[model samples]
Target chain A: MPGTRGRRADARRNATAILDAAVECLSRDPDASVADIAQAAGVGRVTLYGHFASREELLDAVFARAMREADAALDSLDLEGDPRQAMVLLIRSSWRIVDRSRALLVAAERGLPHGRIRELHQRPLHRIERLIERGREQGEFRTDMPVAWLSAAFYGVLHTTADEITAGRLDEADAPGALTGILLAAFTPPGQPVPTAD
Target chain B: MPGTRGRRADARRNATAILDAAVECLSRDPDASVADIAQAAGVGRVTLYGHFASREELLDAVFARAMREADAALDSLDLEGDPRQAMVLLIRSSWRIVDRSRALLVAAERGLPHGRIRELHQRPLHRIERLIERGREQGEFRTDMPVAWLSAAFYGVLHTTADEITAGRLDEADAPGALTGILLAAFTPPGQPVPTAD
Candidate 1:
């Protein structure tokens, strides 16, 4: 029984490795093949197949894992401080996910049901919306634009930054500050002073 | 011959009216009916069908006409003065097209090949790119990010604003100033004094 449990642990570790590698490979190229992901994970094709039956299965696992991690990561951030500082913290943490997961998102979009994607987006969007609401209430953010629009625009900035990176137009290094600065200015009521990215 | 010329002018006027009304109705709602468009145009339903044989045909024509009008409108703007002022002028003109074409764009994306969409974007994107380049040289825009990134980000802002409007999260009246403030802040060479929206 001990030996059996040890083997189960190994299987779990292998499956996780495969999913992580798939995120890396697929995010770099949506066209990345099963063999490519397997190699990146340092597992043989047989080992990968032992875990996931097919490429769709692997992609689904990768997509779900990425979102779950993003959800948990974003949810865990201490968003209770000064609203602007909270936003800065949120942007810093969020950019890492955007940078790593954009390519994988491209892959998932190819084969997944759009309804599933939208469903997954709800929790994360609401989380950001609540933050904006707090900011708006405290007068730390603009009241002129709808809180949801500011949140939606923040998402837009992330995605646009991702596209700009893929197109070789934006450097990854600049994304966090760029996102923060843009959102801060956009969220500030027109006549109010815009905050600079620290 | 004079009578024939008069008939030709009437036909052209009818076609233009239908196209204009199609833009208005479709932008307000993508599911707008042909009857709705014809009525909005103040033309008979038969006249609308005579100009556009089918809904698909009318949508195609609307998309093309909107792009042409946008291209002409943007090209006619003088972009030679202060870089910030030029960008402000560009955003003002571009928002009109965005405000008009966004919902229609949703319909077109549903039925048209994407290559055509990318093709139409090129000229406008390049024009913005050139303006950003000028801004960078004059220290009016950040050189840290790519000129192309700023251009793409501007487009993202427009689309996001349109979506926000549709979702009832943004007001149309707030968009032009919102677009200008965000871009001016985002594009200003970071660490420099950010310009207030005029």
Candidate 2:
């Protein structure tokens, strides 16, 4: 029993190391091969294959890992607060996770099949949809647009803002606050005066 | 002299046909070949080569044509009105132009050199920059963020909104109005209450 437990721990450790290494490698080069990933992970090709049958499988694992991290980040936002404040928290938290997962997301978009990619986004999308619905119900967000379109726009702006940060057009330090302000302003009920200086 | 004039007319017609076909072919498939474009244009390979010596030259012509069309579309917008109302007209007119040139833009991103692509965008970017500056001068926009970043964000949101429209996530009819409202709201001077419900 003791031997079995020790072996299980070893396997788990190895898998974690490989996943981390794969994320790093693939983020740097989406076209990286299994041999490259194995070298980065300090594991042999055979050992890498033992854990993931193919490069596709390894990429899937990396994408899954990134999704889990993103979801975990979202979960930590204490989403039950005031809808406006909760949204601010959500934006700040999600942006950090996006910054960390940038390379993984790029790699997945390039290498993963569309269906798999959509599946990976499904959970996050649902969580965001629910949040938007809550905001609408609470009268924090305007009811003019459907929750679906607003959710889509939310993602769209986040991505564009990230691109700006990456290009040095926008300061990373200021992005979260700026994004929160822009999003809230855009969603304010039509005819409501613009937000006053806080 | 008559013979020369007749030949010039024929040459001009052929050039127009070739350029139009190139736009259509490249938009449909960025990887399309010169031969494919020539066939679509109903011009012999020899004649196509006679007008443009290389594929690169042909692509440059297609990009130039698309830019001109976009510029013309912008020209139609009455930008002399209230800055905020002017922005709405600009968004609506520019979006229609973007919708038309969507294919060309995608192809150019894939096929054109980065420097050349940036050059193509320079004019339109300047136009947008000027519009933003005018808004600030009129005190319709916030003075806190740099005009440059706001311009970048403007393009980013426009592109994302375009994507949503293409995917049927946003209705074409609703896009211009939504985009204008969103942009105005975001740029409204800080500390102002949200716009009254119109």
For every model in order, the TM-score on chain A comes to 0.77, 0.82
Give per-residue CA lDDT, model 1, range B60-89, as digits (tens).
888887788789888989999998889899
CA error at residue A170 for candidate 2, angstroms: 2.0
Per-residue C-alpha lDDT of model 1 across residues A1-198, encoded as one tens digit per residue: 559889999999999999989878886788799999999999999999999999988887887777888999899899997888888888778778878777776676555543355456667778888888898889777665556666767777777788667656677787877777766666665455556655
- Global lDDT of model 1: 0.77
* Tens-digit lDDT track of model 2 for A1-198: 559889889878888889989988887876788889999989899988989998889999888888887887687668897787777777777778877666666566456653465567667777777887888888777776656666666766776666556556678777676777777787777666655423
For model 2, residues B1-198, the per-residue Cα lDDT tens digits are: 559889999999999999999998987887689999999999999999999998878898889878877887686667886987777777777777776666676566455653465466667767878888898899887776666666766766776566556556677777666777677777888766555322
Give residue B107's error in model 2 in angstroms.
Answer: 5.1
Please state every model's RMSD to the true fold in angstroms: 7.9, 5.4
lDDT of each: 0.77, 0.74
lDDT of 1 at B12: 98
Clashes of each: 1, 16
